[model samples]
Target: MKPAVRTGNHYITGDVACAEGAIAAGCRFFGAYPITPATEVAEHMAERLPDVGGTFIQMEDEIAAMASILGAAWTGVKTMTATSGPGFSLMMENLGLGVCTETPCVIVNVQRTGPSTGLPTQTGQGDMMQARWGSHGDYELIAIAPSSPQDCFYHTILAFNLSEKYRVPVLVMADEIVGHMSEKVVIPDAREITLVSRPRPKGRKDRFRLYQPGPDGVAPMPAIGEGYNVHVTGLTHDERGYPVMTPEAQEEMMTRLKGKIRNNLDDIIRTEEYRMEDADIVIVSYGISVRTGLTAVDEARRLGYKVGLFRLITVWPFPEERIHAIAARVKGLITVEINLGQVHYEVERCAHGQAATYLVGDAGGKIIHPDKVVSLIQEVFQP
Candidate 1:
């Protein structure tokens, strides 16, 4: 069998790096339908998984692809899938099934410009809100945005860890630019990497309740043939994992689903702050935009402007408190993204009029220029 951890430095695209990272993280099952930019991820997984004693399936479409991973996840193996915009939309129902059933898996949406196949070869960040709310209903999700090929390598592993820990699907939101761009990525020794598995039930198998929440608000998952009666469904089920058609059952199920993520905000949210010490204006961005935001912030600083970049590593379950705090102290907050205003609305809502918020964005298809970001910084510069 081929070694799962290919520990060394290699130059590769973000999609391939994501596959390598999943392999390193103990992900042994991948089900996906081929799509532009994101196809490289599935291609690499198809070639490498069998060599590592893992399974890779090219499902009929994104729906079956999403369903395959969730079913595979129940068998106690790490599972994942990859796709772009159109496939992502198709996966929403099953994605919600993954959520309602509390299935642990990673979904990598390597975004292309799109309202509907707007630009398959080009990059866009239009799916920011969709990643959070697309699945429907009231549920919290953990979405991480990777800024580079290296970020893709590291954060995909993080996505798996978080998914297993919380028993929810975690998203690695990458744009076409980051997904297709080649860069040097270092894969460390397997011993150096940390992996998380879902909590397992103990004691008598007959008495086990499948969805019973432990003190940590997460339930221990059992494999189907473990002699434990496993009943999984998308309906409102009690801790026994059987459907209960009542308002109270729905409330209880929803509480457990939402509480696990909402209660652990500090542990799940990650951001990188650049030059914020005494800065009066802040640039906020994630995924591919962070690269441009960093460049723009540096230029503004050289011109003697007090500016900084607040990079969102975890976009969903957004670091609202941190943004709100910064908004109060800064003269203005500028959000730079490829989308017109998905996350910008979140920032504005969090700012609460304490700071003026501006958006540096477009419909899709290209990365926002650093010069445009700098110009916005100049326009909003205070003294």
Candidate 2:
């Protein structure tokens, strides 16, 4: 198979492609427990890391898997973990820990069906909402959804880049279809990849405050043994890292943490628009559903429906402004997903009554077909 976009040699499964992407982006530590539809990612990392002087650990459970990655990140190592629905649920508590402490790492959720052990091998986008609000309290999260095997390679690298840039944990929310599917992925030469390294602490060691905010709202982080005597905690802390119980300190800390991502939304949010300029109806989708929606768009256009596709590459830090702009021009918005209406609410909220929002979804442990999506578009655009 020929490579879709030039990066390196082609032909790989999405999981192997993602593992290779992480290696290319400088990830040195992987902590994970094997889970179906996502196990290939861990297996590949274990095999690849040792050759490059990196470390890979298979933890006892998903909870341990999540926490171990955070510990590795504190040592200033680029770290990651892989899981499915059930395991993702287990990792939520520690995910909050990584966020509050501003730990930079990557968490890959190759989604499978269900609330609890629903379908171990079947694909579903049921965890879309969980990726944003799974952890407790208010915080910003970056989640990227890949539509194809090739994108899994590119987006995985981007996930690590974003994690390091903002000092926040990032999620690569893939699904079973893309994870197991084999396709050609072109990996770029080492020199061609634009890698983002975390900002390091400067100033005299004694004068340094680990939590001091920079102009961009992100604080420079120091590794555990960097001779900086840095202190880090999940609790709200003063610039020096001591626990600050005062309400003012708490407010300031939370504001900075959330503002870093919010203010940099332009760099953080990404999406793809297809045939949207003359589109009377737009099909909004992500992950595996996006592929189906693309086919639906082509078919609708052939039938003279004037339809288009909007594929979300970045799921979190929702593309509200872009969606609004597109919605203002389209007559209707159609959301397609494997799960029942998870992201549809977001489309509705962003569309804000500018156009009719419709959902074409299924919870039957498989993806919604493109033909079905085309049918929904026709029904909505009936004249």
Candidate 3:
């Protein structure tokens, strides 16, 4: 190790913490484009990656940045990139390629207010849905949201580990507040961190099955120069990784691609429940929205209302089972997000009339206040 990893506690912004976390997670390459709110992540990585013998490349644009990371992942080394809003939109084509190829990589979106530079430096959670469905085609991805700089540090590491373990593009959706806010963060020693690497091919090199999935629906990821004839492409392919254009090939390939993440829902999905065991009203929120939702929950509790928080850690896959189970007992669910109602619909669908679902959000620029969230809870639960 040339620069070596830095292990200790320090006060830092979320973007910086994330860059440090990537280094701790053994990330040796960062490919990204500079954009507001997200540039700090790349800036820190540019400085730190070299200290640890990693490479940082500033691509011409978001499209090339996304492409660069995928190319790096093929070498069996942990890789990552950061972007937000417009840049995120540009990366969709390559993000699909990452998903189809089962490439293990981390994408950090330091979300800023936007609909085309709507508020470059302001915060917004508008991209929640885009993070999930931005890319074309029907496929699944793992996305985690963090509300604090501390969460940013740890979650980025988790994002990389999950990416390697599941062999998919794992996204860390950190909004402007958390990305720019400074907080006390604890960086643990290297040995304390647990990282996952894609399973390696065990068969004879001459007879290797490039895309043959294991019992877990994930195939071993061989390094680029590992003597295996790995044919990687975005096209639908069989077990050998060669492009094949046929309905049968499409069905078989797509099924495994989505199934690998869906089938392991119990392991892939993560959520945080606060006093939900007996609460009549529950607040569903993620990203920066979690902060205000919890504030509302606390005030509701003070007023003697049975209110609890259902904060989402793993935003993608929607945590359907948990939402349904909670909705069954709660009197109402107040879905809180910065976007108008992207995640609210998902919660409502899963609730299925077991409980009423309501939304409290808007377009973005300024964050929704805690009082607004409290008022929504009041409307839903007021007698």
Per-residue lDDT over 1-383 for candidate 1, one digit per residue giving the tens place of the 0 to 100 score: 99999999999999999999999999999998999989999999999999999999999999999999999999999999999999999999999999999999999999988899887779999999999999879898899999999999899999999999999999999989999999999999899999888998899988999898898899999987888968899998999999999999999999889999999999999999999897899999999999899998889988888889999999999999999999999889999999989999999999999999999997899999999988877776754
By lDDT rank, best first, the candidates go 1, 3, 2
- What TM-score does candidate 3 get on C-alpha atoms? 0.98
lDDT of 1 at 119: 76
RMSD of each: 0.8, 2.8, 1.1
lDDT tens digits by residue: candidate 3, 148-245:
99898889989998899889999999999999999999888778888887888897998998888999999998998889978898998999999999
TM-score on alpha carbons, each prediction: 0.99, 0.97, 0.98
Tens-digit per-residue lDDT, 1-383, candidate 2: 22222456778888888888888888889998999999999999998888777899999999999999999999988999999999999999999999999999999999999978997779999999999999999999899999778898889889999999999999999999999999988777677788998889988998998888888888898988879987788888888888899999989888888999999999999999899878979999999999889899999988889888998999898999988988898899999988888889999999999998999998847888889988887676863
User: Cα deviation of 308 in candidate 2 (Å)?
Assistant: 0.9
Clashes per candidate, residues 3 or more apart or on different chains: 0, 4, 1
Off by over 4 Å in 2: 1-7
Which 10 residues in a row give candidate 1 its minimum summed lDDT?
A: 374-383
